[model samples]
Target: MQEIVSLNNRISQVIDNIKKVMIGKENVIVLSLTALLAEGHVLIEDVPGVGKTMLVRSLAKSLDCDFTRIQFTPDLLPSDVTGVSIYNPKEMAFEFRQGPIFGNVVLADEINRTSPKTQSALLEGMEEKSITTDGKTTALKRPFFVMATQNPIEYEGTYPLPEAQLDRFLLKINMGYPTMEEELEMLARTSQNHPIDTLDSVMTIDELLRTQEEVKAVYIDETVQQYIVNLIRESRKHPSIYLGVSPRGSIALMKAAKAYAYIKGRDFVLPDDVKYLAPFVMAHRIILHSEATYEGLTQLQVIEALIEDTYIPIRKEL
Candidate 1:
């Protein structure tokens, strides 16, 4: 219990530091951190110039670890995102050259703009935490995370991520436009220089790993586990959903809810925690019926409806 509280305090410190640069987006910031603590990748879908890159940059700066950014383009190849093997005559061997994917915090800016072949390059790293090249595999650094950003408004040149690729992410977040007051403050703060440029690292890699361990230690009641399963099962049978949440989605929700509970300074999971995160964790994994889309219905709305219909476990176990 004491350990959980200490970890929560440390996590709060990191979030507070990030807020210095990213203004008025506390929920987005929290979800990003939750995904990190859950040891999963994040996919941010939103319009451009709305701090998509800035949020990721701030997160990288707040961590005392090696950071790299890959500007994914249409011409980007698999070797470019991962690494390459070059034959060196002097050494009489093929030396492997590491790419930007080797960093602790990697920002894949405009990920969808790249080709599917290039996007597939990330699948191995995101899931296995290692890259295979030249018949040898190289593991990524500890606390490895991929913060991928995509522009939902622009699909002209972008390749929509396949179900398999999208399932690799633990959570998909959308950062909507800021309020008038928040934008005004943002303009004032950036009048001199960007805050991310001057941001400082608040936590070390070792500390982050310890917090992740604590997140794993968070307790989940049996009933809560059933609740999570029910939600996923309902998604499959739901009328609006053409493709339901997979087993991986069930695990992602359970893990994310544990992290959310940890963030709320609790050692045990709650029904409310699951409720709050269901839409975010399961939205992208679900494919709604065409008629539902035509009716202006969304996956999120369907998930919410399911939640309301599903029974919640009482808090006695906690």
Candidate 2:
């Protein structure tokens, strides 16, 4: 749609501005923005001090959305995340106190540090865009997205996210250490204040919602769709993987591939889009067998092999 085109231009401009603060990782920034436009949550799994929170904060600042950061810890309670229902003695009725989950952009810093029960509180919000409390439901703001961060599994004090929770995220990305030049520039900039403070909003909330619609409408040939499905099927069959991508993962890859195509300024998706996104869209959702890990095979590496092992169909350009 023409409306989508306008929103696409706006998104491009916004990411460009965020780049000034983020300084490198253009691909990661675009993917984050893509997940936002798709109205999906993004789980950023990387170690601390690599600008994970900063990336989310900068995007929040750029969107002018209500930003809330929940520092997940071992002691965090479920009600602490989904909000609690309280009785007001004066009103003689139970009323709900909204929690940080109400915001448009939620920075779930160290999400894995929280207990499994606490992490489960986000499921309803992430999937249904609403939260239920005391037999009543409250709708989350439009364009709601959770940008969750977690350290690598090897890190201490981290718990693995439940399979149910992991499937809800549209994509998982890592913001690895910046290049040497970018790091030097970061040091020079941080001498004053955080670079994110200098960022500005790129588009309005309505514009963001419109962009999500656009990604849904991005053209994908039937053959390409089948290609995506085949890849998911192979993941299930692969010897290395104990658990493959679910039906949800199949759809996530399709949407992410469409978003990736649009970022390259294409209205229609190509095979490369599927290949580039296969790892990020499918990797985190998979479970590698203990034997595979013992043999030093990673889930992502297995996914890469699956993509290679599967038969890919070629599509004619629209």
lDDT of 1 by residue, 180-297 (tens): 9999999999999988888899888888999899999999999899999989999999999999999999999999999999989999998889999998899999999999999999
Best by lDDT: 1
Q: Which segments of candidate 1 are over 4 A away from where they belong?
A: 315-318
Which residue pairs come into collision in candidate 2? Answer: 62-201
Q: How many residue pairs clash in each candidate?
A: 0, 1
Number of the top TM-score candidate = 1
- Each prediction's RMSD to truth: 1.6, 1.7
Error of model 1, residue 296, in angstroms: 2.5
Q: Looking at candidate 2, what is the lDDT of residue 11?
A: 80
